[model samples]
Target: MEVHTVSETPPDRPPQSGLVRALKVPRNAVIGIGFGIALAVVAYLARVLELLGPFAGTREYPVLGPEGWFLVLAFVLATSTALLVASVLTVVEIVRLARTVDE
Candidate 1:
């Protein structure tokens, strides 16, 4: 039987591959993504408000006519899609980073 004690195990910080190091995300990129997500949320709220607020009282969404509503919906979809993509990328990057650790 073999038992690996904590003291015997390698440190959590391990050498990273050249490709991984090259691809490592910068802090600014993460912050940018967060800001993007926040922007998306704000847009979503604005869209909902427009739909349910004063604009909605005019001739069944006159402010946002059929075409205009379509555009807003598209914006919402785009933001949500961006959020999803960012989240997935972040998770994948985290996993990749974790794999580099000795633990």
Candidate 2:
């Protein structure tokens, strides 16, 4: 009589390290990015409405006007900068997570 043996491996599972275990891809990054965008929008709106920072008024500073042109410029610059920084940070985090996961 001949007998055969079976060899099998267990199923994979997610790590459990408290808060670190709860970390997820894309979703967390998207949330962070969305928060950054919202922050930028609020900042821009507050600046336009003269509700942000100390220097809040309707007076010309250098070249742009206070109501339209100045508000638009401020919004553009603030939003762009915020989005750019958020995006870079998100990318970096994703890369780091990927590296760790690979290891």
* Candidate topping lDDT: 2
lDDT of 2 by residue, 1-103 (tens): 9998766975677656533433443455566566666766676677667685666354656666555665676557656765676567656666887899899
Over the stretch 1-103, how does candidate 1's per-residue lDDT look in tens digits?
9996668767777567554445554543565466666666665666656654644344565786755775677567666665666556667877777788847
Candidate 1 regions off by >4 Å?
Answer: 1-61
Give the Cα lDDT of each candidate: 0.62, 0.62
**Which pairs clash in model 1?**
none
On a 0 to 100 scale, what is the lDDT of residue 30 in model 1? 62
TM-score of each: 0.42, 0.39
Model 2 Cα RMSD, 1 decimal: 11.4
Q: Report the number of clashing residue pairs per model.
A: 0, 0
